[model samples]
Target chain A: MSTLGLIFRELRHHKANAALVVLALAGTVALLVAVRILATAAERETRRVTRDLGFNLRILPRDVDPDQFLADGHSDKTLPADAVTRLAAAAGTFVSFNHLTPSLERRIQLGGRDAILDGLGPSVVGPGEKKQPMGFNIPSGKAYIGHALAQRLDARPGATIDVKGKALAVERVLVESGTDDDIRLYTSLADAQSILGLPGRISEIRAIDCLCMTGEQDALAQLRNALERSLPEARVLQIRAIADARARQRQTAEKYTAFAVPLVLIVGAAWVGILAALNVRERRPEIGLWRALGNGSVRIASLVLGRAVILGVAGAAMGYFVGTQLALQAGPRIFPVTAAGIVADPSLAWWALLIAPGFAAVASFLPAMLAVAHDPAETLRAD
Target chain B: MVSCDHLVRTFAARAGTVAALDDVSFRVERGEFVAIHGASGSGKSTLLLTLGGMLRPTSGAVSIDGRDLYSLSAGARTRFRASTIGFVFQLFHLVPYLDVRQNILAGVPRPDADARARVDRLIEELGLGPRAESLPSTLSAGERQRVALARALAKQPPLILADEPTGNLDPVNAGVVFRRLADYQRAGGTVLVVTHGNDAAPYATRTLRLDHGRLAARLTTEVL
Candidate 1:
């Protein structure tokens, strides 16, 4: 028989053995794909979450006394009349900023119970701030309320709420966002300042800018720097850094997969080896005959390994398809806010296809080599 | 032409080192059909394996067409065997899964036009054309041996080695196996047949008998 033909036949004979190897490799590749998808999904979700929360950077006073700021907890700070314009102008030098605060407090009865009132607003920066229109466009006197607060207060869109004893219109009921500041209400900067009776005072400012760092370090550093520069003494606080949190979650997921992938591979290799070795042992006489007729070590190795590769490829392909279904199911459950509300990562499942074949080849190495190493003469003499 | 000079083969089993062949010397020229007759455990099979280069003799020189088999590197020896020799066993060690045609083609160097043609011709000559696609398990003893013979001749090797080519066949089928061997000889191919069957004596150009791992007697065609 031809070398390749012989190899094909050998593999065909040991189909089950080869299949086992392929299955193992497919599992490894699937694991790799899953971890990859989870990681990418986590990243995508973080970005979406950040956008939904309405801010990237929180700007506060750099030189204010920390003791005094904390003493006025949750209360409006009375800065100089020009303090908001000055801080806005300085921040405008480097980046865009939007300042916001609770405008009016609403006391409403819902289900015969009193409801808590909170407010949100867009911050005001200098006219030099890029994208000035979007930063300034907050429907004045209109407000958005949290779903929980709305439910408790029986609040509806366009309904009026008693904010600090003044009637204010509720524009929309906010979705339940999973962030630290989700329970509060939101309104325009001008309206919040007027109703809170703290004119020229701003609680927080949001900045939309990009930074270049990867993982937790980048995120923590960016938050620390923005808060330190904008509100050094004011004690800059962040609602949450989604990217860093997701990164941590992905890291934890990958760590477990890393441990599991190799364990599966090891077990798979062993199982394939045992099966192949037994096959070779059983075929010793035939192998001896072929060797005596003139086949070489390489030919014999091919005969054994070729069978394994075929099986490996089949199993891997099956596993990849299964993994794709799994990813589809997982995407929606994990992050339901993307374009399709499902992960569309281009690099998601493609790498797995290539890795499956290599896994099969690797799994067959020892058995194929061992088969060729047996002495033809000794085997023929074994009776 | 193939010749063995001062060949010594020993096996180191768990008990002790046992000598299978000791200082055995012999020679056979091209186109000669020689019979090596020996009783069981008389090293007839060991001689065949040694000549096939499957076993490394303890001390010896085996020369095929003036090239010492042992002196060649392992890879070179393998190539030499592929191009120069064909072997057949008494049990007809056909791969059970492959059909008759594939079993015959197994001896040929892959994809060689001349080898392919040679196999085709042998299959036709041995009357296996109709059974070419039949597995060995379904073939009769004589037909299986014919397939084995076709395989040996397929490579057009200079030397043919047969170890009891008809040992498993009845007298009638044994004669059929011998006829194929005789036809091979007529085609100018040198062959060595190792067997205890005295019935094979008539077909050999010369017969050498072995006793106790030593050459005992040589009888020519005229004597037979």
Candidate 2:
């Protein structure tokens, strides 16, 4: 009879033992798969939540006065509008900053009242990145009037307003915010440059730092170094509060996964090893009989390790299905923002199939060796 | 033919070292039926295992059909033992999961149509036809011994070594087992049986008595 035939018959006779092994393997695989999928979803959710916190890095012209820029909430000194293009074209610029938007902000008189006129240019992202542009994109002939400014100027949606002898249609009225934005009027960069009589100039380039580092890591130093190499004429200023929060959230997620994966593997291996040892103990006489019947060590070891491989394959298939289903069901409740992006990952199935069997075999290695090294004469002569 | 030259086997006990076989020497020609009789702890089983190449003697040597059994590599020795000898134990160490047919087939070194046919004939000759497909757990003690004997003879090796083959059976089952071994001898196969009682005396052509790991006496069947 074939060795496989014997194994199948033995497994059928010892149904409870086989079932327990398969269940242990399945539970380990399930936990790993769930953790992997959920970790990805958590990262996506964090990126979305933090992205909404707004740009935290402002790049101003090197000669700008810090006190004047802070008090006025706008820079008097300006750089060429093409400075945003030069920085975007620099090597490794996106590695330190993203969502590069050029803006020119100034205080001007509108309808006899002082208001902030903010000119927003198109955003340039990293190569091959499909991220949505942050903030508003205003057309050259249109304006987005804030609540206080719209009330003071009697401007509503679809109403044309006069600014510096230029007529611009009001596209939409922004909602009331408690910040200075409530008295600001948004326009295209070309419109602001034309109206201010200073063409091809922008006050600052706005961006968010890409270094997800805590305050202790000196993230500002790294940002400044990267800026110095790429755009020496401009200096970078980072908002500590927002950057620190994003770093802490990302690190916490990573630490959770690092702690979880190994714990599952160790427990899984121990469970498999113990059960395999028990199986070898139960089949002592059978092993002796085979040895006496002229079977070699390879054949004997195959009987034990082959069973583990078979069970591992079964467990991998079952675990992948169950874990994917679990993630699909419970993911949206945990991260509702990117819940729709959660879907079954086919590559996980391939990885599970490749690794689980090898893991089981390694776990059962000592037991298989014990079976091979067993002395047949001991059992046969004792009988 | 089998020959043992000053065979010595020892064990390590808590008290000290003890010898299981002390300078034992013997020989059996081809087609001879020999029985070794000894009391419990007399080392009859140890001597049988040593001769079967399952246990290596502490000193001296054993040669089967002129091949040095211990000098061969472990793998080659195992393959030689598979093709040359058959073994039967007292406990009927049949695989619990396999049925009688599979247990008998397990003995064939390289099973083919001839081996399968021989196994079928042995099953019928030993009166195990009705229980051929039954697992060892459901069989009676006598029937299990019959299956074990059939397994030993299934390969039709030149030599058969039985260690208390009827130790667990009744008088009637013991007689059945001896008669089968005698039949194999009549067909020109060498046979060696080790037992505590004289149950195998009637069928053995020669009997050797062992006392305290030493050969006490040797007698022919007619001398008994």
Candidate 3:
């Protein structure tokens, strides 16, 4: 009979032992798979929640007065519009910053009332970054008028409005945010520069900081250092509340996975090793008999290790299915914002198939060696 | 044919070193059924294992068919043992998971149709046909021993080493085991049986008495 046939028969005879090993392997794989999928969903949820908190890093012209800029929430001085491009093109700039939006914000008279005119340029992103742009992308002649400003001007969607002798189409009315945004008129950067009589100039660049570090790590210092090297003419200001919240959320999720994965792996390996040892112990007499029957060490070792690999494969398949189902069922309730993005990752299944068997084999290696090293004379001569 | 030259196998005990086979020498010609009888701890099993190439003696040498058993590499020795010798243990060490037929087939190294046919014949001769597919656990002590005997005889090796082959059987079962070994010997195979009792005396061509790892006496079957 083939060695595999023997192994199968042995596994069938020792169903409880085999089932326990498969269970341990399956549980470990399930925990790892669930952790991986859930961790990804947690990251997505963090990004969405933090992105909704708005851009935390402000890149203002270096020469702007700090007090006046802080009070006015807009820089009096301006940088050339291409400064955003220059900063984005800088090496490793996106390592600390993303979603770079150049804007010219200033208080203007609209329909005989004071309103903030916020002109947003096309967002400059990191090279090869697939993240969706954060803010609106308005056309040259279109505007997204604030709720109060739309009421004041009696403007509706697709209505034509006049701004400094230029005609602009009202694209949409913004929802009331109960902030200065309610009285803000948003337009394309080129239109703002034209109306403000400062063509090709932007007052500031808004961005979200990517340095997910705690306050104790001095995140602002790192952001400043990065900005100084990338855009020497601009200085960065961080909104502490938003930056800290995003940092804590991201770090918490990372810390959870970092602690969980290794713990599960260690416990799983120990469990497998112990069970393999027990199996070797139980089969001592049979192993001796095989040795006396002229079976070589390779054949003896294959019996033990082969069973582990088979169980590992079964565990991988079962765990992948169960874990994917768990994530699909529980992900929406946990991270409702990115629930639609939580789908089964086929690559994870392939990875499980590749890794689990090797892991089980490594764990069972010592026991297999013990079986090979057993002395046939010891048991055979016992009579 | 098997021969050993002044073989000495020692075990390290807490009291001191003790020889299991103390400079003992013997020879067995082909087609002979030899029985070595000794009391418990008289080194009967040790001598049998040493000759089987399963145990390496502390000193001296063993040759099977003129090839130095210990001088060969471990792999070569295993292959030599597989092709030249078959072993039956007192405890009937059958693989618990395999049925009687598979356990019997396990003895046939490089099993083929001829080996399978021989195994079937041995199974029938040993009266294990009804229990062919039954695992060793389901078999009685007598039946398990018969299966072990069938397994040993399956490969039809020139040498059969029976270590207390009937130690766990009743008188009737023990007679059946000796009869099978004697039949194999009559068919031109060599047999070596080590037992604490003289249960194998009737079938043995000659009997060697062992006392405290020494050859105390040698007697021809006519003396019995």
Which candidate gets the maximum DockQ versus the true structure? 3
The predicted structure with the larger DockQ, 1 or 2, is 2
Tens-digit per-residue lDDT, A134-187, candidate 1: 222457777677777777667899899766656668888877765423445566
> Candidate 3, which segments miss by more than 4 Å at Cα?
A62-68, A85-96, A109-115, A126-130, A137-185, A211-241, B12-19
Per-prediction TM-score: 0.76, 0.90, 0.88
C-alpha lDDT (0 to 100) for residue B165 of candidate 3: 96
Model 2, residue A30: distance off in Å is 0.4
lDDT of each: 0.68, 0.91, 0.92
Query: In model 3 chain A, which range of ten residues has the least summed lDDT?
Result: A374-383
What's model 2's overall lDDT? 0.91
Q: Candidate 2, which segments miss by more than 4 Å at Cα?
A: A70-74, A109-115, A138-179, A182-184, A212-225, B222-224
Give per-residue CA lDDT, model 3, range A196-271, as digits (tens).
9999999999999988785479889989999999999999989989988999999999999999999999999999
Chain A of candidate 1 scores what in TM-score?
0.62
Candidate 2 per-residue C-alpha lDDT over A226-249 given as tens digits, one digit per residue, 9 for 90 to 100: 999999999988877888788888
Kindly report the docking quality category of candidate 3.
medium
lDDT of 1: 0.68
What's model 1's lDDT at A356? 60
